[model samples]
Target chain A: MLSEFDLIKRYFTRERAGRASTVLGVGDDCALLAPTPGMQLAVSTDMLVEDRHFFAGADPRKLGHKCLAVNLSDLAAMGARPLAFTLALALPQADADWLAGFSEGLFALADEYGCELIGGDTTRGPLNICITVFGEIEPGHALRRDAARDGDDIWISGTLGDARLALAGYRNEAWLDAASHEQAGARMHTPTPRVALGRLLAEQKLARAALDISDGLIGDLSHILAASRVGATLDVDALPAGLALQREDQALRRRFTLAGGDDYELCFTAAPAQRAAIEDAGRASATPVTRVGRIEAAPGLRLVDAHGVPLALSLRGWDHFQQ
Target chain B: MLSEFDLIKRYFTRERAGRASTVLGVGDDCALLAPTPGMQLAVSTDMLVEDRHFFAGADPRKLGHKCLAVNLSDLAAMGARPLAFTLALALPQADADWLAGFSEGLFALADEYGCELIGGDTTRGPLNICITVFGEIEPGHALRRDAARDGDDIWISGTLGDARLALAGYRNEAWLDAASHEQAGARMHTPTPRVALGRLLAEQKLARAALDISDGLIGDLSHILAASRVGATLDVDALPAGLALQREDQALRRRFTLAGGDDYELCFTAAPAQRAAIEDAGRASATPVTRVGRIEAAPGLRLVDAHGVPLALSLRGWDHFQQ
Candidate 1:
């Protein structure tokens, strides 16, 4: 078996491209980063455990990408620029093939976003990957959960529910054709971080409050409403479902689109006056933006149909420890 | 069973003392940190898995303290001031009593250092704690491993071998009296991070290179030598042992002190000319500093007795996956 130090050197350590802010990276007691002046660092951490977050035999390559991607998604929701991240991983064994594939996928996405892997710790245990990402944003410009205002239009970037749909297929709760399975599986494995869209929204002052929808749209949106002390009137039929999910029955689509987990899409609010600019931001980032609802001064969420009639639906987000 | 969100809110989130550096602490997509002007951010991460890092049914409080202490030890090695940290935790279940004890121990140390709990993730799985600490340091003043120079005197903070001695007792490899066991076990459970000593070393330019000893002195010292392209002549007999270990046989003391893991003490190198200044720094920080070796121009480690007689011994550091 390879020693811990050897494993880290062989798999995790890599040469940097001389990122100016990274004063010292791997092979030190700590990695030193010089944040740009006038910029506040946005930080987020997420932990993924085998069996709970992914299947036991999940692909190492995709797992690596998803772990880092989820953390980057948090930064995206904050409208922050990705800077660097640290990964703490635990493995049952030091398998060269698994490590090689994992590092390849990790660096591929990291390189694309110019996010350097600064430091990490690896140990022997049941598999777990915890990543903490750091991003840069100007002060007072962050799209905070408490910044939503009454009459603001609620918007969503990209589609939602495909990851949840794929998960249902895996759990045998739903049947899927080969093509549909592959397409939805890709959404679950490689959800894109809407960094460009989020940054555009914040920089252009088009979005007020924002968050990435990880645990279903309605549940995550409730966090924004609760924090901002506002309510929302959601147009349930207006939600942009995943391409595969769009083909499902109305009831299935409604459940998944409204309360699906692992969607990794941005749910944000903006003033109605910025509709044209928000549309322009969508086009500029090459991402689709959908108007799903409107924020209200009332302190409770209300659901409606396409014909403006109220809908009574009982749905909740994914909770890891919920019984 | 408590939901993940409820578990986090109930135990982790607390009212902040209005630390100026923390712009947004918790309850957001991401925590925001404003680093002081001209100060670089030093980051380090550590992951501790139950059964691997600690015994099963270990005290939650001690486990929490050790997890954070180990990460803080890295920051101390870099001569950085504690700023904040994010935790990613996995647990088998939501036990309120365990959560209370863990958070209490965690926050107690965090408050002592004025390190805020910026953010974290909670999930259901086998117990694992991963903490990434962020600290502030002036650029170019980080005590890097590569900064060691030839002819530098190597110094250590606090005592060593106690943690390993406790491990030996637990493993039934050594017999220790109840009093000795308690003393050594405390060292293992709640080892203090030498933050003050490290900061003094960096701020006053009292040390050339430094690293916290985690996997034995000889093994960790080798990292400094390899990075700095230097060798060292260590007076093995001069190593300071824990008070409990001091009562042991010389051979046992030497074995544990030279190759003990989990010491969490600082192993730093400095110019011999600054001996007086180094002593003053130790006094100021209230940490004992002992000179046990010197960096050499040659490229190999040499272990010597107090009389300068070279001693031959075969021992290696703890490797997590070593077979």
Candidate 2:
């Protein structure tokens, strides 16, 4: 096996160091970045652990991509333009194949989003991937949960319930059709970050509050309501259910949509007057902007069906500590 | 026990939310940071794991401080002014007392350096702490390890080997005076990042290359040499040995200085003409800068005694993966 230094130099440093807004990149004590003038940097961190976040036999490439994508989702929630990131990786052993695939996936997404991998530390330990992403947004314009008002519309991008269904063995060889299996697996593995839509929302000053749906839509959306000191009434019929719900009963579909996590979709609130503009922007960008809910005057989350009847849920969403 | 959200809001968010540079802090999907104009951002990350990096019973406050301090050392090596940081922590359980002490230590240092803990994520897993520190430097002037030249003078800030000595029980409770033990413990726990000295060096453009000594002076300085494509020769007698070596045999002292890690001091190279200026800056800042070696035309590290005899060692420093 290659020594740690050799491994880092051979694989990690061999890539062409992209020009950064920072003054320095790799081969430095720290990466120095120059934030664009009039912009505030958005920062978020996430950690993915083996077994806890993924299966032991999961593909390394997908692991890397998902780790970064989750952080990007956080930045997207704040309407921040991708800039750069740092990765902290701990592994049980050095696997050349794994490293290659992982780096390929990580750099591919980074290249797509124009976010450079700037600085990081690697260590030997149980498999853990921690990433901190930095992005930029104009001062005073970062989408925040506390900005949501009582009368704003709550919007979510992309279809819901697919990722949760994927997690429920619906994508397994025994349960899924070939095409459905492929689609579900892809959704589980390489969920796209809503960076473009986030940037557009920020540029247009459309979103009052925004966040990505990582925890179930209901659970995460509840966070916005709590932070804004307002209640919300989600229109269950307006939720964009995915292919996974095609064969499911209404009850199952509702459960899946309400409790699905890992969707990597943007959920934001907009003033009533701005809804038309937001829908237009989403249409132009080829991204869905479904108005699934509305902020209300009370202080707790509620779901209403097509007939305006309350839909009850005994559970909310994934809580890392609850289990 | 507080739920995850409540824990974050009550403990993590309260201290880091009010910093002037923070446009938006906790309770949002991401934190927004507005950098002061005329300053570039310095970014660095470090990860610590249970068993691998620390004992399970290690003091939470010390671990928190050391984790943040290690990243700060990276920023210091780049000659940056500390600004903010994001933390990703994984723990098996949430211990209220441990969390309180940990956050206290983190925020104490952060307040001292004017850095805010803008964002973080906590989850249930084996203990893993990953901190990414952000700092500011003058545009285009961050120090880097690839700038050393053949004729530069190598200098180190403060004394070395104390942290390793402390870890080995050499300066532990029974072996040292109370004051000495306290000082040694401080070295191992709350290391001071040489931020001011680094900033002064960068502002004056005095250093050609720089790095923080985390993996021993010899090993980390070798990094500078490798990056700069140059060699270095150290004067054995000029090494700044600390109280940890006061009563030790000369040979053991030399070994400690050579192979010891965890000394969060700055090792840098500067042209001979800049030596006086460096000393002046060090004196003004009350930080010692000692010229311990010189860069060479060759491309490998060498150690020489007073009579120019080479010192041989079986190992150079700590390698994270070495069994």
TM-score of the B chain in each candidate versus the native B chain: 0.99, 0.94
What's the residue-level lDDT of A17 in candidate 1? 69
Report the lDDT tens digits of candidate 1 across residue range B1-323: 77889899999999887888899987898999999989999999999998888998889898878888998999999999999999889999999999999998999999988899999998999999999999999888899999999899999999999999999999999999999999999999999999999999998889999999999999999999999999999999999999889989999899999999999999999999999999999999999999999999999999999999999988898788983
B102-128: candidate 2 lDDT, tens digit per residue: 888888887788888888898877789
Each prediction's DockQ against the real complex:
0.92, 0.74
Q: Which docking category, incorrect, acceptable, medium or high, applies to candidate 1?
A: high
Model 2 lDDT per residue over A203-263, tens place = 7899998889888888888888878889999898888877765566687678778887888
* lDDT of candidate 1 at residue B22, scale 0 to 100: 95
Minimum summed lDDT over a 10-residue window in model 2 chain B is located at B170-179
Clashing pairs in 2: A21-A34, A22-A32, A22-A33
What lDDT does model 2 reach?
A: 0.83
Best by TM-score: 1
lDDT string for model 1 (A72-130, tens) is 99999999999999989999999999999899889899998999999999999999999
Q: What lDDT does each candidate get?
A: 0.93, 0.83
iRMS per model in Å? 0.7, 1.2
